[model samples]
Target: MSEIVFRSRFDNGRRKAFERSPKVSLTSPDFYFSHCFGVCRKKTSMGPPGIIWVASRVTQPDKLSEERFCEWYEGQHIDEVTALSGVPAAARYEAVPMSELAGPPTAETIKAAEQRPDYLMGGKWLTIYEMKDVDFRHTAEFKSLDGQSKPKGNLLDEIFTKAHFETRFGALLSNDDKGIKKGPGKLIISATMTPGSRASAEDIEQFYEREHVAEIAKCPGYVRTRRFRWVDTTVLKEFERLPADPIEPGNSVVALHEFEGPYFPMEGLLKADETPWTARVLESLKKNGIEAGFYRLKRVYGEWLPGSSKL
Candidate 1:
């Protein structure tokens, strides 16, 4: 029998190893997607090429002050990070205060956002960057041509000191919004968790790919769901040349949902569904481990500019 093979629609009859995540083509049959009966999807889409996610959270140090920090970040920091060859785009988000978050909130999620532990990256602030298929570790700006440490010069000086910050990098596993618009929407649901020690990561990924995501689509105005695994820093000798001590990644996978209009992302999540599927899913995540939150999106720059009252 002739061998049956699977490959992307973009494949030129050659199978190249995917660098981080598999390259899914536009015409693949098993595309990740869903539909909300009431919310119609716009006829626009902006997707990443083998998207790698880089998320960092931070806090304002005692002396730097919020105003100075904003001026510095808005004036320069955002540009520097986005300019890196691999990075396609960058955006900053301020965690909505626990009181303002939607539906019934999870206490642990609220606490984690407030505490901003080393593992959680930073307190109150999250900077998300979308990286293309390129390996950031090998970039000229990140490392020397001969494989040596390369300083970001004064840009490095401006960061790390002004606030407490850390990050986690990973590839796109599955996204309901794979072909959806990459707009700066008004709300986001960011949930992070590690799988049970006994269960392989693939098992968790497959479960979501097959079930949970579709169930969550029932939530009103749901736009998309993007899942990510912690980038294993040790893979490419990248950690050796880096400055920050990448804390051990605990919450290995993060599921982010984007929503717009008047609906809340957690309206469905916070309420326990009395079904075998969702109940088991939640039970499994808990026994395995989970940390999550509902955040109202706060845009930091551009046309959505704010006065001194904003962050």
Candidate 2:
């Protein structure tokens, strides 16, 4: 569980509120709300979390227009997806642009010193859907989501930027819930990897779960994380996609690292418990190292809103 401590009065109120809301009552234990990560929850009590992301873009400049993209997402797409059996929770986020990546280390720009040009093939505005297993993408509900099960209005899909409307899958590897009030950060720093010729995917995955995450938690603003692979997609239908779609390649690796930050310092991570394995891991991926991006919170909406929305 998250290290979210509340005053006795507040806790009692939250419990009472949870008891009152039918949705909250039915979703308790499965959906634990937190501020650090907007409306996040584990897919299962003891299993890997299935992570999928969708990207969208802005259309106009008013509340109805500016947030229409998000509204369609939160109100329609997210609601439909999370309503599935065994599917406990879901969340959405906006990718923080380079303009906001100010201060010491990030001031230089996350991609300015681009060593791997082809890796950060993600979107600026993204939403993540978490489920009980990677196979949830293959469920009857998801089949509808894939445009293979059923169809009707599909209004939300109409507002999205087709090109930016990319999707990717990830298998939960490590999560550190001990850091702060919620997740470790106010921001999510991602590094999607492409294995090099000499790199062993098996070895890197094992090291990441066993050693890398624990070491990363030592960083100053570090929090929790959810790591997944492109292979974690639907077991049945292969998604039809544009040629430029990143996930279409089916050979990407993602690690969404959360941090309590105005920024996640590269030096901070390097300085945190610099074991010999850290250097080895770095050296291993040198051929095609981490292609990173920082995603910030845009707006969060769920059935438990106005109450646990701030939770």
Candidate 3:
């Protein structure tokens, strides 16, 4: 199993509330959550929250009106898609006011329809987030795809979706964006490579050097990437009672890269039809013989509001 921490880079007030009093019951209304990692039986540190909820009206790029897009999105119920993908934690959806949304949202201009009383009352942008958990990475499942079950989607598709997710609410974290906590916009992207052929310690070291990992700093949004030697135990028990059910302990090297600044700016480029640049970066890694799947993460938090139930 793998675990990660997720957080938002916007709203210092909310982030403070989450950290100061973090923990929410699964039954809470304002705190809807979900996780790709597995079941979250208990809570952990409530670090802080971020604006990560994202939905795109232009999946195919027909350029529909904001009203038409909203209607279409509601009809599709993409939330159900998120839930069905084996969410390990509970998550909720929030509609942020246009003023609160990170980026400039076109949705704000649409007036509420005559019958939609509830629609006009809230903000134009929406936010969805998962509940807090300490051991999120440990619950995620990473399976090998056989030649038969290879992924059907192209790399551009995957990166675009993620970029959109990270960037949609990223505007709030911008240097000029107000109410951002000092450390609000920090983020990490982790990559776990399942070697096509088992690699030795020397091989790993050589790969990193050969792949020019030292040059990651050259990238525009590049922060820092660290390589882990793969700790076999998920938890340490008194240095005597070893953890019983740890995830795969062999043949994997974990690389963690930290990104500071905005949520994910890569999506903006992708959305604007800049696949070549994105592809070039990805291809560069492949050229260096480095193959790994990248997963981005943030920290979610729960601020125990007065009258909020605890589990």
Candidate 4:
């Protein structure tokens, strides 16, 4: 049997809610077989088939106030995008600051906080648009929103000049729907990564389906976890050209975990990952690295209905 330690950046400041205790090893072959077999029961398809995830940081706040920026985003931009055929829903989120937490800071937490960008630490805002399929990008309605087609002096143009954006398109891989709560949780953990050369996509998928998601589910307030594989965005870039320089490409995979929260359940989450399987998976992906952030839901836009402008 292999001994693999569980370590997380959230483990530093010990809060009663975030503490972990050791558990009996389940690394034996029999346990692995039975656990994997039982947990891998058949299910419906993953999550939404296609999604557009955009994270933004306001670089020139003097030129555009956050209030005005959000007003245009929620009031106008979301309406424009969701009105297109095959696009049904969207939501917005804001990054949560570490200083707002009640506990003392841990070294790891401090380091993580320090690494965040000064503009907003993690991204200041995130918007997610759900599509019926990845092919929605090729539709004429979508193409009409291209840079060449936008009015010269639109609010969107001003937004582009004042904000930096990172966008990703994801195709669903798997979803643990059994644990999902009634509505979107107040907090979301967005984790992006690429599997290292040592691991295959199947390895990552199986690990989440069999162990990782279930473990996280054990934590208090855990809502659901959805995983996605990155879709190439070369074409999207050609369509929606903005004022800012192009952003670097995103990671190959993303996992979104929703949690009901007053604050992040760091202790429960750290303890949840205390398994040999988690250690093994993390080690495999270590070479590629993981980027994760905490964001709180600011607002949610339900499915777009025909002939309705309501967001």
What lDDT tens digits, residue by residue, belong to model 4 across residues 1-311?
00000101121233232334333233343332222111122334433476777776666778878887788777867777777766678778888776543245777677676665422324678777777775455444554552313333553446655665556667777666555465567788888756664354457778788888888887778877777766633212112323211211333677888888677788877887788877776676645356677788988786732111111
lDDT of 3: 0.30
Residue range 90-194, candidate 2, lDDT tens digits: 556666655444454464565574453454534556666565665555433544452332123543234422223445555555554556546225677777665
- Tell me, by lDDT, which candidate is best: 4
CA-lDDT, candidates in order:
0.45, 0.49, 0.30, 0.58
Per residue, candidate 1 scores C-alpha lDDT tens digits across 106-219 of: 776667556543333224555555655423433335332111222235423444334443345555666576323445456776776665544645566766777778777776
Clashing pairs in 4: 18-267, 19-267
Error of 2 at 169 (Å): 2.4
Q: List, residue by residue over 1-311, the lDDT tens digit for candidate 3.
A: 00111211223464455557656542342332221112234445542222223322223233334454444334332332224222222222233332322334344523322234321322222323232222222232211111001223442233222222211111110111111232222444334343434434345456555553544444345554445433222221111112212122334444544445544334432353243433333333322233222223333233311110111
TM-score of each: 0.60, 0.61, 0.27, 0.69
Candidate 1: the clashing residue pairs are: 57-122, 58-122
Give the poorly placed runs of model 3, Cα more than 4 Å off.
1-185, 199-202, 233-247, 263-311
List where candidate 2 sits over 4 angstroms from the true fold: 1-48, 58-66, 102-118, 146-151, 154-157, 160-163, 197-199, 206-211, 232-240, 243-251, 265-267, 270-289, 300-311
* Sort order, TM-score high to low: 4, 2, 1, 3
Judged by lDDT against the true structure, how good is candidate 2?
Answer: 0.49
What's model 3's lDDT at 232? 29
Worst 10 residues of 4 by lDDT: 1-10
Residue-level lDDT for 242 in candidate 1: 31
